[model samples]
Target: MIVQDQANDFPVGPEDTSASQATQDQLHKSYRMPDEQARDPALHIAKDWVQKKKLPDMSNITDPQLRRYATLYPKLRLTSDGTLFLEEGTGDDQRLRLCVPAALIAEVIRCLHQHPLAGHLGRYRTYLQAKRRFYWPNMHKHISCAVEGCTTCRQSKERKATKQVPLGQTSTKEHTRFAKFYCDLVGPWPNARGPGTKKYLLTLQDAVTKYPEAWAITDATAENIIRVLTNEFFPRYGVGMTIVSDQGRQFISTLFQHAVKRLGVFTVKTQAYEPKTNPVERLHRTLENVIRCSMENEKVHPTQWH
Candidate 1:
């Protein structure tokens, strides 16, 4: 016979020995025992001992659940109305946690985990909250499974760590000062100045000596890049044995390629989306910081960046 609590619409009676059709349906949906079983037999036995103010005789208790209760007898408590509780802590910090049966374990966890105030906390936090109010065998394990299986958590929570391949070294032992160069373009600064009101910077760094250079230009076109490399850079530094750059349009343009080829310089482009493959990328950050600090110290407006 099933006894229902009208006020809360919850099942309060122990389950009948024969499973009903509704019970089977609920089992299919949740894979848990029916809600009709509010009291486990093991807990009932423990409650009897608690009410009588005596310890249970565990020697003959062969049932696994009953044996489990026997082991927890020291912390078990019973109320006058037959409700079972597990006592935790001592003295002023004492707490009585309701001993929940297997049938209602899922419901309890669902309410605690999905509560608006609870805000769908992770496994350990949900376990801590459940532990404060309810007691059950392997409570942490149950809560962990519930939290892990939650669709909302799986969909919304970001992974704690992302796997990535280690960065490959770009320099070799045979490299020397000015022999290999890493080059990139930086900005269209909001503040434009100098001849042609230059607003962009073309930066280059030596792989071996770590030497760096930059030139301001009005645009990052292939023509401007070729002019900087052929007329200024190659003449001063001599044609680099090799130059590493990103796959930007200015660097990959036919004009830029032909100019480097004629100078007898081998050009290598870094892999797409892999900035670390070009060492000059790191120099950009330091360059920006130094420029910003110098401008502030000299009270020079960024328009004079050229």
Candidate 2:
């Protein structure tokens, strides 16, 4: 209200004095400032200038860090009893507000966001609650970041792929490193490549680490499937003790069954049409989302996932 407009070098004119003082009085009565800023050195200096007429010469205020607070001195005010306030917003909507220290911003954001009546509400609602009583630079950015990173909001509010079934009984069993894996097939996706115009993605996931590997294949033949397992996967990670896959033709074929047995790896097939019995099926949604977002962000062809 009756703030020193730091941008201006001169004192207030006589005509503006009464109205400005009245506005300041109204604000002081309507809202209370937080006590935290009273101990803040920057605010102490600001208050000295605004309320006690003790403005220190720039050179005398030796802390270079204080310059940031000094710059805001003109916009800060102190009530008759010495509570610090900041003049914010614009005319008709302009008001004095409690100043929040940098250290307390996160706590303030959490309190407002998780307030019983307002918990899990979106950004704008949380911001309004904060703006009503607190004033800070880049307050909106702070609020937005806090709300977006909220764990509850991420888990419950955000849209995600529907789960087909609970994590399978096999998934709950402890898996030894390089001993158990979940395998699945994804796509007849666009942008087919390689010999036979590859269109399918063969996905393998290590159950212990949850690490996944994928390869593009033109067909789901038992020969191609066995080749991926023996040549590509087995060589790098060593032969797993057990391999789990949906009961697709390629997985259940005589060629695949014999090939895995010869390699000393046991094969377990999921119940018919129950893809969730193989853990890798759950990862397909996440994998597709990753590829879709990457293509959108990088301006690449959708088939680039191949």
Candidate 3:
């Protein structure tokens, strides 16, 4: 794997045309010629360095071992056209890979990341594209940095959005069943009962068992909602200590507030736009699916959805 040529052990020999052709074929499978000379800034630096037959001095390298390698290694070999490169691998696996200059690292990354034929790819794919024909110190780090900074690549990829802060304890201190209920309004569904008869849906779910209760109401007004809660919900599930609902006008109305307060019930309202905080909102999707599928089948009519 270490394809270096020193005075002893591994010595640099005359170039083999057949072996070189094979390497070229392998490289050709992945490598595409850059569109213009200026596009890959590393190539320009390499060309200039080769033309001058000189490399930047690394005499100030703090590590003695690294200073020695820096002083001796790069000058040991070059490509046929005199471009600076590191000879890697051994025997049949040997390859002459481009030695990228630090100044051109960003440019090289841009070229590889946006390579017309192979650009706009993921981090690993972009890294492999560059790896096929180039070498540099911390090459992977640079490639990863480039991919992370690439707006096109980042925007094109589909990724899930995760909440940074965890929702600690979701429910109230009360541990009793039906102690807390999450309430929300589903929608103004398409005219299910003739025209505008049963347009809105009121969804209620228990915080403990996740058992859901829903009612189809003509409107989302306070009177209509309190009727369902008092007659249908409270009678069936029994009144709980707390009612959690979103900040809808109906939930905050004086009539509904007085109605719950008369029952010795506490009302907790979730912040606007924070749908996840309201557990009943999660059930709306399943409720909608059930309603839609049932309406489609001949056995169930939309008016009978309630």
Which candidate ranks first by lDDT, i.e. highest? 1
Q: Find the 10 residues in a row with the least total lDDT in model 1.
A: 1-10
Positional deviation of 256 in candidate 1, in angstroms? 0.5
Candidate with better lDDT, 1 vs 3: 1
Model 3 has an lDDT value of 0.63
For each candidate, the alpha-carbon lDDT, in order, equals: 0.70, 0.67, 0.63
Q: Residue by residue across 58-152, what tens digits does model 1's lDDT show?
A: 79899887787778888876543345666778776665666777777887787666653355667887787776656778888898999889876
lDDT by residue (tens digit), candidate 2, 94-213: 666666666667866776665433434668877876666566667899999998897666654536566698765543576477688898889787666556777888999988898889
Each candidate's clash count: 0, 0, 0
Which scores greater on lDDT, model 1 or model 2? Answer: 1
Return the candidate ranking by lDDT, descending: 1, 2, 3
TM-score of 1: 0.43
Show model 1 residue runs off by greater than 4 Å: 1-172, 193-195
TM-score of each: 0.43, 0.47, 0.42
TM-score-superior candidate, 2 or 3: 2
Task: Give the clashing pairs for model 3.
Answer: none
Ranked candidates, highest TM-score first: 2, 1, 3
